[model samples]
Target chain A: AQTIHQWPVAEIKAVGSPLSLGCTIKGKSSPNLYWYWQATGGTLQQLFYSITVGQVESVVQLNLSASRPKDDQFILSTEKLLLSHSGFYLCAWSLTHSQNTLYFGAGTRLSVL
Target chain B: GDQVEQSPSALSLHEGTGSALRCNFTTTMRAVQWFQQNSRGSLINLFYLASGTKENGRLKSTFNSKESYSTLHIRDAQLEDSGTYFCAAINTGNYKYVFGAGTRLKVIA
Candidate 1:
């Protein structure tokens, strides 16, 4: 079975501080990875998606960036955190272009003070 | 442009009762996937339909590509079914999935 793991389940940071969240996929290689954000009582918004290493596409840019340094590792980072950036971040993976089903990670809750 | 729109933004049902959730797409979709976001905020994939209907236990889903719509029917609802339901569509041109706002369902015992 495949599993997606995300670190720092929850975080509270001050405005203007940097932010970094990590996600790792197990039991799958070269999977398509995605990053999503959901506000309090709101819908999920696609932030970024990567098809392979060193290639990431931004869907709804909020000045945030994504990186896939390894086959099963994806990272979401920002230099300056904003209050608007506070939300639930989710990492998902799909079986390349052959599969449309997305398996999501546990997610990280970030709150900017 | 909103590619996908889900009906019944919120719903409340009694245990054993049933209801249907619908999603309409503005463009032709290659496939549609239904998911349930639990209280803990983890999304569980319920059904992934490319063209036809599929059933599992008390949940069933149907996708019509020509009509550009999909439906999910929940029979004999239970308290554990309470959560937010989301429908995402895969676009043929790019294979990028666009998700709906979601339908919040609360089943009370």
Candidate 2:
């Protein structure tokens, strides 16, 4: 069975501070990865996606960036946090070219004060 | 432009009753996935249909690619089933998925 892990389950940071959220995939190799954000009571928005190492695509420009440093590791970071950046972050993975099923991690709740 | 539209927006049902949630696609979609977002803010995958229909327990889902719509039927609704349900579609040539705003379902005892 494959599992996706995301951490710092929840974080509270000051404005203009750097932020980093990490995700790791187990039991799968070279799977497609995605990062999504859901504001308080808002719809889920696609933030970024990566197909392989050193390759990433931005879906929404919210001053946040993503990187695929390793095949099973994905990181979401920002140089400075904004008040609008507070929301729930989710990391998901799917089989290569098989987008029918996507497995999500536990998710991280970030609050920028 | 929003490629997916889910209907009812919100629904209230009594236990033992039933209802259906629908998703209409504006473009050709290769597959459809249904998910239930629980109170804890976790999304649980209900059904992933490439074509035709699939049923599990009290849940049944049907995907009609030609019609560009999919439906999820919930039978014998229980209080535990209360949550926001979302449907997403994958365009024929695109791997990215477009999600609906989600239909909030509240099951009353």
Candidate 3:
């Protein structure tokens, strides 16, 4: 079975500090990866997506970036953190870019202080 | 305007009762995915429909491309089924998905 793992289940960070979250997919080959964010009580927003290694697409501007360093690894990072960036981060994967079924990771909960 | 409009922003129901959630797309979409977010914020994929209908246990979902909408029916709803349901669509000519605001369902004993 396929599994997606996200690191640092929860984080409490200060404003202006650098932040990094990682996600790795196991048992899947070259799956489509995506990053999504949801505020405490807001809707889910797509931040970035990648179809292949070394290529990521930005769907929204949130002063954050995502990279696909390896076929099964996806990294989300920012030089600085903002209070507005505090939320739940989720990583999802699909068989193809257009495949309807998306398998999501456990997710990372971030609280910016 | 929202590309994907989901109805009943919030719903409350008694245990054993059931209801349906619906999503309407503004444009033709290639496919639709439904997800259930638990209290801990973990998302579980419920249904992925390209067209027609699919059923699993007490949940039944249908996607109508011609009507540009989809529906999720839950029968004999249980307390554990209470959660936020989200619908996302992949429109034609795009790899990104447009998501609905989500329908929050609450089941009370």
Candidate 4:
């Protein structure tokens, strides 16, 4: 079975502080990975997606960035946090492209103060 | 523009009752997927339909690409079935997914 794991289940950070969130996929390799952010009771927005290591595509500009350091590891980070950046960050993976069903992680809940 | 429109943003049902959730697309799509997000915010993929219908236990889904619509039917609902249901489709043009705002369902016991 495949499993997606996200780190720092919940975090409260001060505005302007640096932030970093991580995700890892087990039991799958060479899968397309994506980053999604959802505000409380809002839509889920796609931030970035990567088809392979070291390459990422930005779908929406949210003052955040993502990196795939390993085949199974994806990282989301920002130099400074903003109140507007506070939300739930989800990591998802698919067999190939967007046409396939996405497998999402438990997600990281962020709150910027 | 709401490319993927879901009806009845909210719904409530008693245990053993049933209902259907619908999603209408503005254009054709390659495929559609249904998901359930519980109160803990855990999202679980329910069905991935390219066309036709599929069923599992008390849940069933159908996708009509020609009509640009899909329906999810929950039969004999239970309290555990209460959650926010989301429908996402892959655009035939780009394969990018458009998600519905979600239909929040509350199945009371």
Q: List the residue pairs that clash in candidate 3.
A: none
Question: In model 2 chain A, which range of ten residues has the least summed lDDT?
Answer: A95-104
What is the lDDT ranking, best to worst? 1, 3, 2, 4
Question: lDDT values of the candidates?
Answer: 0.93, 0.91, 0.92, 0.91
Per-candidate DockQ versus the true complex?
0.74, 0.64, 0.75, 0.64
- Candidate 1 has what TM-score? 0.98
lDDT of 1 by residue, A12-35 (tens): 999999999999999987899999
Identify the candidate with maximal TM-score: 1
State the lDDT at B71 in candidate 1.
99
Query: Looking at candidate 1, what is the lDDT of residue B100?
Result: 92
Worst 10 residues of 3 chain A by lDDT: A94-103
Query: What docking class should model 4 receive?
Result: medium
Runs off by more than 4 Å, candidate 4 = A97-99, B93-95
Identify the runs in model 2 with alpha carbons over 4 angstroms from their true place.
Answer: none
Task: Please give the lDDT score at residue B97 for candidate 4.
Answer: 70
Kindly give the stretch of ten consecutive residues in candidate 3 chain B with the minimal lDDT sum.
B90-99
- Tens digit of per-residue lDDT, candidate 2, span B1-101: 64888898999999999999999999888999999998878989999989999999999999999999999999999999999999988777545878888
Better DockQ candidate (2, 3)? 3
Please list the residue runs of candidate 3 whose C-alpha ends up more than 4 Å from where it truly belongs after superposition: none
Cα lDDT tens digits for candidate 4, A1-111: 998999999999999999999999999988889998989987677888888999888888989999999989999999999999999999999886445788899999999
